[model samples]
Target: MSAAGSSTESARRVAVITGASSGIGAAAAYALAQAGWDVVLGARRLERLQEVAEATGGRAIALDVTDQASVDNFASQIERADLLVNNAGGAKGLERFLDTDMEHWEWMYNTNVLGTVRMTKALLPKLRASGDGLIINIGSKAGLDPYENGSGYNAAKFGLKALTRVLRIEEIADGHPVRVTEIDPGRVATDFSLVRFDGDQKRADAVYADKLNLSAADIAEAIRWVASLPPHMNIDTMNIMPRDQA
Candidate 1:
């Protein structure tokens, strides 16, 4: 990756992506690496993160987004970053509010809500230093419309959308060139449901059994496009889903 604010014309840009061990985060890391951006990956699973980093020829760091010290240290290690992809989050289960475990609710709140904020806060300095920074928050369609038994997950995403909107405005007002973008995608065939169900393969597979689903590559491409835009251009928001999905 190029040094921060260097004058070399052909210097490669740097991108930092969280949750880069698998799913959309991994796909985006590979895509960015291939696009000539030096990438730094962060995730809880060190082995998986190492695998993706080696495959993409990028750097990897073990990160637990819920932990403040970890996030702070990771931010300090990044000297320059033109893009920050906040993609670390997941649901717990499909259960009514009254039936859900309080621990599940706490877990969702910690990772999905506070985790994003911690990353953004920690990275803002480096992002601002780059002079052409982009922040992409991976939201979900559930944020737009809450479904039965999806109260906790939906609430976190909805808060994320609001957070992005506010950050966009604040950054602009502060004369920072940082751009915030949100990509709210519908259901995709990923380890998302599997983790939510605590490794119930049968139940996870059932979510996409009869329908065409989005791949991690799909969302990765969208993120790449948003990050590749001209300095004067910004893709503020995008929502993508499979054709069969409504």
Candidate 2:
């Protein structure tokens, strides 16, 4: 490639997305790529991640967000990151606060809350250097409205909401160019239920069956839209829910 061509390619905005192996993450990767943003995908499942990368013409790197070493390695591979989508999180189980197992809570907190912290910490420098950086944290409506039998997941998402807000405030106070936004979705039809139910396909299917539910692609569109907006604009939080869902 000529120097100009290389420069143009380098100038194209690049986005990094976690949990890109499947669900909303994968859809977001495709949507961003379709919108002319170069995307880098990361997930623990390398094969699935590679498939999405291939389909979207993006790069895939194996990443386990819950692990600090993995997060470090993932960050080191990226040369530039104008957008970072922290989507690598899920619920383990649904139980009442009284019946909740500490193990589930630990997993939820580590993956949903600490995982975002690790990724944001690792990539903040690159984002700041980009001059126009954006970080989109995938949160859940459960964070705002707690429900029965969802203590662990609710707490984790609530924590994420708090973290996202604080990060935005800090960036403003520090006069950094980086922008922070949280996309809090109510219910998207994805493998989230399967993971939460521990591979119980029936239960997972039942969650969305005969009910109006959002799709991963729906959330991906929101992500793409948010990233495509002018740098001067910052959407602090967006809550997406199906029309039928109150």
Candidate 3:
């Protein structure tokens, strides 16, 4: 962390990134830090978050979006937040809806939908305090178009889509300056598949095998661009896919 009253730290904006321990969240931290934003990284994994924070010159705070207390504690550490990247979300299983374990559904919804809610609500005050706050909710292509055996993840992302839209409407209704954007990407190569398959490396590896896929950095760049835009500009929603994803 930079010394208090340091001009460099004071001049730069602060961005809080959830799920910053890995994948898109970690990538976003580096990208934002590089672009002169003081990033606050949050995740359940302390070691990974710490490493990312050190690498990006940011701060690491243990945050579990699924836990309200953790979210509150995480928010308490952030005195100022110009941007909140709700990136701490993922899929859990590939079984069809009927055959899928309920536990899979619960975890997916909790992490992807409710988790975003917890963080957004916790950080909204500061984001509003920024005078030109921005919230970027990381979404998935599954949210846009569901696929076979993706019932749980699809449901979570779709719910996230609705949540993002409603929040945008509410803020607009209240006439707040907060900006909301949802970026949905397709075929990003990350640990996402591995986690979804319960660490089955072969199954996870096959998802992107012999196919074009986006990197975590690619989605992170989109987030950076959206955040860097003028306050009056709103991306609304953006869907980025690999050239060959279709």
Candidate 4:
């Protein structure tokens, strides 16, 4: 933890980000910190997470969003949070529906959908208390478009999209100032393909070998922009894609 992480600087809004070990989550933490927001990073990889925390002058806490106990413990450590970026999600396999693997489906649903639910439910109170809270969910283009051999990931992201929408409606209906936004990125070049292919470097390389892909920083910029908006303004959903991606 850095001095900023320990400071009683109540004026600097705190943003809690999950999956902050790398990629969009880590980038968002840096972007927000640079913009004067205190960041609290959470991820399963404590070492990598701490590196990001150190760079951002934020605190790092071990967190596995797919685990209920982990989410609870993470929530307990956060003293304040004006923004929550639910970014811990990814694809597992690329098998077709007929050859569906339940394990892949389970992992996808647990991490992408239920993980957000667990984190949101645990920290909703703190968010409500903030008076100007915002929840930004990192969804994917897979959720909005159906493609071959993407059953598990597509379904998981689609479920996340539904959750984002319903949560937004409920918050509004309940008269809470908490804002919800979903950022669906088309194709961001990250370790996402490597993990999905289970560390097959060749397979991962092919994902962006001959195509224009968005960088993690691109999505991170979007997250920062949404959080920087006025409390009264709610950007329900933002679909960010590379120019060549239709």
Candidate 5:
């Protein structure tokens, strides 16, 4: 290919996804890549990231949101990101406030709240330079409703909601073209339960056995639709759940 052709192709809109090793983040990477965006995936798992990148014709970067150096290095790998999906988060343990392991709460907070903050800060500049930037933060139903044994996870997601809101408000007030969206999904069957239960497959399977749960693809489609909208239109928050969940 000619140098000009290569440059033109490289100039396409870039989309950076955190936690792109699996589940919702991976799904988003594939969806955006198929739609012609230059997808750059970030995750701690290099092999998994490479696999996703290969499948989607994207690039992979090693990222650990809880660590500043890792995040800075990851940010350096992406030049112009018009879309940033902060999906690198998970529930640690389903425990009531009193019964909770404090360490679990820390993990949840660091991954969900702090992680989003770190990634957003690192990518904000590139996003702003794009002339039209968008951030999609994946939240949860727990953010809206506190339930038994959901204190830690709920707290983290609630914090994310606040971050999403404040960021949108600040950007709008500052007269920036960056759009922020928070997608709160309920009961999507993923490895969420397994991780929450510390790699217990049975526990994970039971969570979705009889329920009509949303797939990673379902969430990915919503993300794709939101990203496809004109720059002037912004979807603030979308609460998605299975009919049964409602």
Candidate 6:
């Protein structure tokens, strides 16, 4: 693989993207690769991960966000990282609070909150060492404005936003070169709803049946813009949605 940050030469930048099997994460991986950053793709599916890695000429590692061992192993395999895209989170069950199962809530908490934390902790040192590191946490607009029957998903994303903010301040205080950004997207047309609905394709289709929506490429472009900025500048946070979404 190209040396980390070779695109800039002054500093080699390497990006690690999680949940890169498909959708936004996969698009982001391609965008970074196109921009000349060596990329590392992480996800649970080896076959899909291999596809992305081969396409981008990057590396792929099997990663299960909710499992500590898997997360650790993924981190250990990385040599240097300039960007960590914590994009491996999603909503599990969309039932009302009273009807929500504990398993669903647990899944959300583990994957969204704990998973981000696990990946951040494992890669922080490399980020700090890079001298101009960035962390982009993928979140949802629902995290800011809740929707009915979205308690579990909302809670996890809300926590993710909070975590990103806190890390931003703490890293600056510690004189670290790391920056944290949280991207909250609204109604993206991806497999997100399908996964949320537990493989119910028809229900998933209904989410954006009559509405304009952002594509995974849209978010990936935004991410690339933020990462390509000068080392001294950071985008901090952004919220993107289709014009018709609101």
Instruction: Go through the candidates in order and give each one's C-alpha lDDT.
Output: 0.90, 0.93, 0.92, 0.92, 0.90, 0.90
For model 3, how does the per-residue alpha-carbon lDDT over 1-246 read when each residue is reduced to its tens digit? Answer: 221112464567889999999999999999988787899999999999999999999999998999999999999988999899999998887897789899999999999999999999999989898888999999989999989999899999999999999999999999898999999999999999999889999999999999988999999999988988888888999999999876
Candidate 5 lDDT: 0.90
lDDT of 2: 0.93
Q: How do the residues 1-246 of candidate 2 rate in per-residue lDDT, one tens digit apiece?
A: 211112357578889999999999999999998888889999999999999999999999999999999999999999999999999999988888888899999999999999999999999999999888999999999999999999899999999999999999999999999999999998799999999999999999999999999999999999999987888889999999999987
Q: What stretches of model 5 exceed 4 Å from their correct place?
A: 1-10
Give the per-residue lDDT digits (tens) of candidate 5, residues 1-246: 210112358567788999999999999998888777888999999999999999999999899999999999999877688999999999987777889899999999999999999999999988898888999999999999988989999999999999999999999999999999999999898888998999999888998998899999899989988888888789999999999886
Instruction: Please identify model 3 stretches exceeding 4 Å from their true place.
Output: 1-8
lDDT of 3 at 125: 86
Best by lDDT: 2
Backbone clashes under 3 angstroms, per model = 0, 0, 0, 0, 0, 4
Which segments of model 1 are wrong by more than 4 Å?
1-10
lDDT of 4: 0.92
Model 2 alpha-carbon miss at residue 231, Å: 0.7
lDDT string, candidate 6, 178-214, tens digits: 9888998998999999998899999999999999989
Better of 4 and 6 by lDDT: 4
Ranked by lDDT from best down, the candidates are 2, 4, 3, 5, 6, 1
Candidate 6 segments whose C-alpha is farther than 4 A from its true place:
1-5, 8-11
**Model 5: residue 145 alpha-carbon error in angstroms:** 1.1
Look at candidate 4 and give me any clashing residue pairs: none
All candidates: CA RMSD in angstroms?
2.6, 3.1, 3.2, 3.3, 3.5, 2.4
